[model samples]
Target: MTRSVYVTGIGRGDGRQVIELGVMELLTRHVDRVGVFRPLVHDDGPDRLFDLLRSRYRLTQPADSVYGMGYEAAGTLQAERGTDELVSHLVDRFHAVAREYDYVLVLGTDYADTNLPDELSLNARLANEFGASVLPVVAGRDQESESVRAEARNAYRAFDSMGCDVVAMVVNRVAPADREAVVERLAAHLPVPCYALPEDSSLSAPTVSQIVHTLGGEVLLGDDSGLARDARDFVFGGAMLPTFLKALTDGCLVVAPGDRADLIIGALAAHSAGAPPIAGVLLTLGERPGPDIMALAARLAPGTPVISVPGGSFPTAGELFAIEGKMSAASPRKAETALGLFERHVDTVELTKRISVLKSDRVTPMMFEHELIERSRSGRRRVVLPEGSEERVLRAADVLLRRDVCDLTLLGEEEAIRKRASDLSIDLGDAQIIDPQTAPVRERFAERYAELRAHKGVTQELAYDVVADVSYFGTLMVQEGLADGMVSGAVHSTAATIRPAFEVIKTKPDAQIVSSVFFMCLADRVLVYGDCAVNPDPNAEQLADIAIQSAATAAQFGVEPRIAMLSYSTGTSGSGADVDKVRKATELVRERRPDLLVEGPIQYDAAVDASVARTKLPESEVAGRATVLVFPDLNTGNNTYKAVQRSAGAVAVGPVLQGLRKPVNDLSRGALVQDIVNTVAITAIQAQGGTAQDAPSGR
Candidate 1:
């Protein structure tokens, strides 16, 4: 339940400040309480930045020193600062933080040498210590490594050997042309996500002065020195009013007048210093700070910026917010403005796309994409669906019918449709409801049922029985060429949905296999995980085939398929029949299809680790990373994908039928009405023929 990521680096540099900015921006769209931990901070008299964090955030435990940790073993020069010593110390710090927080972010000290072995050993130690996965980034405020590729690969190997699931490499300050080379280098060796960051000096330095100055505030303390300023996500805070609601926008915001709020927000935000970014927006008293007010700030900002507290007091009119933080009166304008700002940009649409991933029990529909709803002028794939069942199902059908995404044909009794709609309080005139109980389909179903069952399993009892289930009858409509695609998994199992398709529509030629892809989505990316729920345990050839089909499906979803044959071992690291299966499967893929970018015998991280690609098997096309992972077996594939789905708080979209001539989707047995509608949309889109879309920018 406590899923944490270890964000380690060196000193305060290693491009950490920039990396932290990216992490912080990423967190805003996803987590809530991201914590940071620096196990080793050199004891150089007073750390002004850390101290200011304490005062401004009002943290109970100053991040400076969580406990009475003395100055005895602080820097790398200390005898106990060796890798093992450092890892042990790091592990201990993680454990301590893990107890109180759901997830603890472990930051590495810049004091350690940026050597591959040491960095990996350090991560392995911490992963075991905190029971976490490693998302390693190559940190350093240095030029591109002309040849540090080998070292990066070495680090990945260590991380892989230690069983870290996912790994990432951030090539800091990389040139544009070098981007391809770097990507190829890493892709050859590792199987992971490798991002080559361009040199944007803009995000490197974050000065508190800039923040304060931007808001016309002042630097309260630590005015000079290595204080960071480039924030990925920003928050605006005010003690008086109109501030707390701004948090709804881009970053997390706090509404407090003074140090109390500052402390709570600061400590919580900075917990994942290297993992994700968090900040507080401070609103001072009465706008203009008198002498005393000015002095109070000199202690808070340090090198960070401080904004001037608001100055004017406007009149309150109506019911915007009847109360503030302490239940004070709020002006209608001020309160409404703040809330409006949040709603406009805080990403409700993206949230809608990944509802399953968030795993929250509550949700408000935030449909913002026109593409999901709009039909092409020429590509209207009209679908006929039944109407009148449950409130949720009816409402869902209406959404599609109204949106023109599908031409729903609702089948039911005429009076029953109206009565059911009245009971559910939904309008049904917009959708077509054919009364199968009294109309043509009822007669057609009886005729067809008798025609098919007449051969052997003949009986009037069987004919009536078969014609009764609406789903079965609906599939027959499609089989009889009455409809293009049928969506029938609202209150049924995968078998129920597929059996009809298999019996009626049947398989397409060249489509030798039948499997599925569950679209795994997070904030910034969408991954197509195949054969997860479908093929229980496929052979090597089947896996290779699955990889190929999944790749094609991913392309349809607008993903460039860099396929990785996912295995327990990366290359020849481990020996077993399972690993070889992946290896052979990967080979078969290359032999059969040479146009694609594919590789195998790779671990999860290697398929994703760009840095890992830079070294191990660096010349191989798919060692370090593969975005589309071809799992060696269902045991590892199903469980690993699901674990990532649940553990990382990701959404799993479907066991979308692949390698089939037609689009037939399976739904969760206990799916909601919206689930039924969405499944229909997915199937319709595939049938209608649109380019596969890129992952929705994860929320």
Candidate 2:
């Protein structure tokens, strides 16, 4: 049976969309196929929240299938055909979606401008009929802590009285200072878990695109990225150029008469100079700057949005002030902010238990990524990123911090990192920034490096120069226990990243050699491909060691260990040195760990395909169900993994180095922001002594 969660607001301005989006994220983290249904939507053109959810989560549900009816139609049906008929129609539509998905996120009726009577009772009735547990949202804006707590309790009781399963209550938009008090008070009185979300001005602030839509303005200039910026404050430019420039603030939208060319040029110039970066410029009174002035403005700030409105400054100001930001398909940064807020404030683990959705056995790429993040958060560890000044690294840092996954230390020049973050509009919240050349720890690191490399004819002076390199500095931090692990190579070479580790944090006592594996996240399940990164060629004994290490790494991250010794031949089909090496390695694995299921000299097709396995080597336990595939050589392994990654559209998450005393992973130089995030999370998990049995289960 499909499980469902109903997210409904008690009234308008509850900011329930955050909870809805958050719940959808939580659902997707555990299950593969999730459906979204909104019982009643405003008669407006399209539901912004639904569109946002579909785009953000990549929902495959058709557009017409997501909604039952608009508010007007719902109200008309309720009035003419009675409430029973209205609810029956909605329930039927919802069941159609529920049957097609593993789980459904049911958005209840929004009590905004609806003629329906007793919306709370209606929402409760629909939730009960849909068989979804109700998660009620209460607006705590402009309310005292006590009042907010009382309102939350009342909302819960109202649903419970109607026989609705009240899973949890969320009090959103509470004042930052009162958030703790509200949560504490509700926790003492309410039977269910309650979360209080402090008001984030950014969530409420309108973006430049929203302002353009509200004023029906024409966009004379700006890119989508610039338009997506939040207009935190409105700066009116009636004053002279110098005073108006002083009035500008970061993320403020400047409003001035289009004829005021001096103020316009001054504001754009100030923004270009980075005195205080404005969101965009808004022109009023149906006036526009001359072509030359606009060309100059474009040169000043290429992507900055310059909008023209037909109304005067006063009316435009009023309209702008009245406009509030909505989470939609266009505003992804806001969705990130929303997810960050929700993950931080809510105890998602407890909430997931309350929701009681059973974990799926099949792990998709999304599920694997989500599990990595959740596991990293369970036992937080510090990870160092040596490519801190790199754009991808800084962006990943922003995401990791926002999601509160783990503590991060970014290695680079502090000023340059900050400047780059500012230019990119990325907030690297509280991430430790260190410049290796000037950091006080550099001297200590140099001394430690000299001690570690003393046998290699390295003096302290030579070590000092070597420690200045970001990769070595990061690896040294991991070695010296200053950081739990390090992830680098977004810009540096893989050798530059792991060489310091070889010198300082060497292989474990039981390990023979260090090797790397790429977690090949296919459409249905995750498979481990070993020795694709570090080793070029290995003897039979070293190949067996890599197999054992790869199995341990696979089991550490929740992949089952059924070993497949991949070769060009299966069974006794062919004879060659490569085949002989694989055969010997397989024998070594079975002898060393008699409990492991091993298949030797097996072709890739026979190892992975059950039909082929039956034809080639029938009755072999590891032939057709292998999860850990050990390649014979790097030349073959690297090319095959890349081939599958590009052609099959798989998410290859690694080159994760194994068999180190402390974890130090390297990224591809072309790693994306998400790849960096995944690698960092993996590094943190490695630092936590990652074990599949002890880690949180996605299944």
> Which candidate tops TM-score?
2
For all candidates, what are the clash counts? Answer: 70, 0
TM-score of each: 0.45, 0.94
Candidate 2: tens digits of C-alpha lDDT, residues 1-699? 999999998899999899998898888888889999988877667788888988877788998998899889988898999999999999999999999999999988878788999999999999999889999999999999988988899899889999999988999999999999998899899999999999999889998888988889999999876788889999999998877888899888999999999988888887777677788899999899999999999999878899999999888888988999988988877788898899889998889889987777778888888889888988889999998889889888887987889999999888778766655566677899999999899999999999989999999999999999999999988888889999998889988888999999999997999999999988888889998998999989999999999988988998878999999999888898999999999999999988777898898899888898989989899888888999999999999999999999999999999989999999998999899999999999999995776333322
Residues 1-699, model 1: lDDT tens digits: 555655554232344433433342233224333455655554544443334323422334546434213334533423445656655665676566656643344554454333334434554666666666565555423545545355557657767777765546555545545656776787677776555544433233233333444444433333232122223233434342323333423222222344444433342333223112233334454233356544544443323233434432121101112211110011111112222222222233332232212322211121112223332212556454543464556666655543345666665565555544432223343566665555556566666767765766556666666666666666776666566566655666778778766655666675567877776754345666777877778888888889888888777655678888887677788788888788888888898889988877877777767787666668876665465877766677678777987788765667678766666677666667656666677667667765644322212
Against the reference, the lDDT scores of all candidates come to 0.52, 0.89
Give the TM-score comparing model 1 with the true structure, all chains together. Answer: 0.45
Segments of candidate 2 deviating more than 4 angstroms = 238-248, 257-275, 286-302, 694-699
Q: Which ten residues in a row have the lowest lDDT in candidate 2?
A: 690-699
State which candidate has the highest lDDT. Answer: 2
